[model samples]
Target chain A: MFDGITPQLLFGQLLIGVINGSFYAMLAMGLAIIFGLMHVVNFAHGAQYMLGAFVAWLLLSTFGVPYWGALILAPLVVAIFGIAMERLILKPIANLDHLYSLLVTYAATLVIEGLIRQQYGSTGLPYSSPLPGGVNLGFMFMPWYRLWVVVFSVVTCLATWLLIEHTKLGAYLRAANESPEVVESFGINVPRMMTLTYGFGVGLAGLSGVLAAPIYQVSPSMGSSLMITIFAVVVIGGMGSIAGAILTGYTLGIVEGLTKVFYPEAANLVIFFIMLLALIFRPSGLFSGTEKS
Target chain B: MLDDTTAPLLEVRDLRAWYAESQALQGVTFDVRPGELVTLIGRNGAGKTTTLRSIMGIVKNRKGSIRFEGNELIGRRTFQIARLGLAYCPEERGIFSSLSVRENLTLPPHLKSGGMSDEELLKAFPNLRARAGSRGTSLSGGEQQMLAIARILRNGCRFLLLDEPSEGLAPVIVKEIGAQLRRLKAQGYTILLVEQNLNFARSVADRHVVIEHGAVVDQLSNEDLAADMDRVKTYLGV
Candidate 1:
């Protein structure tokens, strides 16, 4: 089964896996944060990711902004859009059942996708490789931007982990997760925290989108399809945990990459199949400390 | 003695509160003086929890005045009420099972007046020190209750509304909790405790109030409560 797998091809696939993993890690990290604390499984996350890419494309094509500026501006722009959704759409339904949040967000996703499709058309828009060189790593040739994506994503994930786990705001967030009433007593406004947390999570999706624009063609449907795979990663990782999302995202991506080398037909189905197995064996996901909250 | 010169720390007048369509507290009235340990004794569903919930503004569809140190509590959010120096420990013991005992204790946001330092908080509850690194779910039930109380203490709230601190705990742990209540009282913290255990109520309550079917049935000092066991049994079914 492994006879035809060359080191060069394997290394190339691994590089691809790591890139995919970076996106998976970033997107799933956002999903876990929102779902865990706010109890909102934002179906709009993928649409936000797509919007991030579009924002970057628009900035570059229409305004002649550089890639560096789009990297920062696109996420901020998308994050504001996310905040708007939280305030106008999600906040009213905050007290309703979790299913309503899912339904509302799904509706929002459809609306966003439709609007983008209307403007951008269905054909994939090409984003020129902003960093136009590669480093030869003996077994594999690594694009500088791809390497930058991997490095930047790792830093983002680590920063997020520290923010949630080590900082004062993170403490309140965890406290809110435990007992919002007790946290409220301390005079930390919880609803405001919820709004910001949702925005931040959506911001993470947006960041992933911008990073991915240079790698793949910028398209409205990009985030919609990617979300399914990321959801599988979240399932295998568990929704209640941050580290679980990050680790599972990268691990599953590598597993899928390996599957492509060994059994090409199974590559697409690998993550979903692993999610099923995870549900059966460890329903809480790999790093999830407990069952559902 | 109830403070007469200054307004009561908490005043609830004609407070009507409900859960969805079910009226839990109807025209409830009470006053809790500063530095007092008050107990609300009632059978299950006597609106004991509802009264506390109303004060915290957690109750939906509430009408009436809940003035905490003179601020209107009716429209304030639960977090705002809490920031106003009131802490509510629910009956469910909402511990963050994923966090360590120490992390759970330290996770609350800081307060301006100052909360207990981790060192002092641990000194106050040595049992917690032993289980500081343990996950919240790994601790025993009694330990969890201790952790819950310790959590508020660490947050440094001066007023506390505890719902059934002694429920489902071992008698030894109940006595331990009773001791902590006395210590908290001596430190000048005002507490409104909802309890079913008459003995636990008698141990630390400076004054006692009884509720039946959403109304105040009786109010008495600890001395009067000890003297009138027959009436207590009749009202509380002790």
Candidate 2:
């Protein structure tokens, strides 16, 4: 069973795992934040990710812009879209049950995916790797752009964690989640905070899309397939714990990668299997210390 | 400690408040002088909570005028009302379960001017200091109540609208809370407390206002309260 195992191959798979982990970490972080603070499952996350990739592709292909510029401009563009969705779509139903939010976000996802499909078609568009070449690390060859994705995502995750956990604004965000009325009584505008948090959460998904575009083929449905796996990661990690989501994402990615090496047939089903096990043993997920919202 | 010369700290006139389509308070009127301990006593469904919520602008369907230091509160948001020197502690205690005792006490965004410090909170409820690192959910019910009050005081709101601060607490803890309220009053803070516990109300309140069917049924000072048991029983259903 272990005859084909090699350091070079293992290292390559590890790099791939890390790259996949980066996306998982970013996406799960967003889902966890939105679900935890705002109590919305944000089913539109996948569509938002797809939208970010599309925006980058559109800017690069339509206007002859560079990938470097697309990286910054695309996420900002997607963030604005997210803000619009929060203000116009989600705000009205903020007081309603979580199912309403889920339904609304699901509808939004459908509309977004449909519009993009209409404009761009279902074919996967090619995007040339802007940061070409790789570094040979003796045991494994690491592509420069893949390494960039990992570094960039780590930075993004850490920054988000710091913003939510360390700062005064973060304190307000947490306070609002705990008791909106009490936070309001403390002179903090909770509605504004809700809008910004939704924007920020969706913005993370958008950022991940930009990072993912060069690695995967850009298409309308790019985020849809990945969204299911990320959701599994969230469930396995827990929806309310940000650090838990990120850690579970990266860890599960590695575990999945290892499974791919040992038994390629089991690679796709590994996350789901783990999720089933977790649900049976710890329905609240690995790091969910308390009952979920 | 409320001086007759100073303007009223909180004034409500013909206030109407509701929950969804059901009206909870109708044409309620009252005033809280600065540095006064005013108690609102009534049966469970008599709109005591609604009156407090309306004054804090927590109720969505509310009408009539509420003035805190001469500022209109009818259209203001709860946080804005709080920023204007009003704090509300609901009957549920509203402790942040994820946060520790110290974090819960210090979590409010804006600190009130001349509010109690962490040292003061620890002194007022020393048990909180002993359990500063413990999560809010892990604390006993009485400890949670103490944490809630300590949190609001730390946030620095001068005018407190405390809803049933004594409900469900142990007798010893209720006494501690009463002592703290008296201390807060002596420090020149204005309090409007809504309580079902008559003994708790009698311990700290300077005056009592009873509500029945959302309207003011009676008002009495501590002197009158000492002599009038029948009125208390009738209005408060005690």
Candidate 3:
């Protein structure tokens, strides 16, 4: 089984693994951040991701906005929508059970995805890669767009981690997760902070969507498939653990990719097998800790 | 309404709050003048914590008139009440386990430079200064209480609402906390403390407002408390 495997095959899968890992990191980090702060599952997250890609596609197809401009604008637009959803829908029920948010967001997801499907008829749309070229490293071929995505995702994730762990504003966000009433009593508007935090988390997913548009088809169903994988990533990571979410995301993606190389049949099922093993051994996750910086 | 020229620094009138179907506070009323230290004393479930929480506007389902420095605080949000110079240190101490002592000290936004500067706060809390880089929850109980108080002091709130500052401290630490409060009062900071420890309250507080089953049963100045210790004790059930 190992005799026929070449460097091209090995590194190519690893490259694919890294790219998938980057998306996993972004999506799971967003989910973890939102849940850590407010305990909302945010089922509409996939819809938000889809909306980001759709918004970018629309900007290009209808308004003649270039990919670079869409990359900047799409995430912002989706974040604004998230903020509005938080204010009008999620905020009122925030104090209720954690399951309420999950249900509401689930309903919201259906409505959003249905609206897009109704217009586009569920067919995939093509998005030309902005960086349409590749480099031949002596061992493996590398697409500039894939490399860009990997670098950009890593940068964004690290920036977010630093912001939450090192900055004063991040300190407040983490504090609020522990005791929102106390934070509010400290002259910080905790409710407003909650709203903004939710928006920011959703924005991260939107950013991932913009990045995904070129790789995956710009269809409403795109987010749903990836979101399922991200949910598994988040669960294997742990509840509300930022470090766990990030580390598990990339590791699992790579593991899945490797499974594809050696045993093609097990690629799809590999992540769940790992998740089951992790649950039996370390249910809290490999990087689980109290909601800490 | 006729007292428009001046109002109490902190005032509450007929404040009622409920948690779901259970009523926590039933028409509690109290006031604290500037440059004074007031303590609220009661047995557990007597609504002492609820009263402080009500004044902070954290109890959402509440009907009351809470006036701070002539400003109506009833309908205002918690952060709004805080920005108006009211700080609440909850009974649990509300320490952020994730943040370092230094981060916790600086987490609250300073509305103005009034109570104490960061350096002054650190100087006052020697333990906090020593363990500045440690997580907020790593401190001892007494130290955590001191850090909780110190965090608010550096936050620029002139009026402080502290719930059970001396609840679980040693007699010596209680004395130290009492002394610290006295010093804060000397610097013209008004404090409303909820106390389970009668001796600590009798030592530091200028006055004691006794709560019995969610209402103000009695108000005693230091002399009054000293004269009638038994009655205050009966009210406190300690």
Q: In TM-score terms, which candidate is top?
A: 3
lDDT of 3 by residue, B57-93 (tens): 8888899788888999888999998998888899899
Q: Hey, what RMSD does candidate 1 come out at?
A: 2.2
lDDT of 1 by residue, A75-180 (tens): 9998889988999999999889989999999999999999999998988999988899998988889899999999999999999988887776786787787777
Q: Tell me each candidate's i-RMS in Å.
A: 3.1, 2.7, 1.0
> Model 2 misses residue A204 by how many Å?
0.6
How does model 2 score by TM-score? 0.94
* Fnat score for model 1: 0.67
Top DockQ hit: 3
What DockQ would you assign to candidate 3?
A: 0.86
Cα error, residue A192 of model 2, in Å, equals 1.0
For candidate 3, the docking band is high
Q: CAPRI band of model 1?
A: medium
Q: Clashes in model 3: which pairs? A: none
Better of 1 and 2 by lDDT: 1
Q: lDDT of each prediction vs. the true structure?
A: 0.87, 0.86, 0.89
Clash-forming residue pairs, model 1: A184-B79, A185-B82
- Residue range A137-165, candidate 3, lDDT tens digits: 98998999999999999889899988887
lDDT of 3: 0.89
Alpha carbon RMSD to native, model 3: 2.2
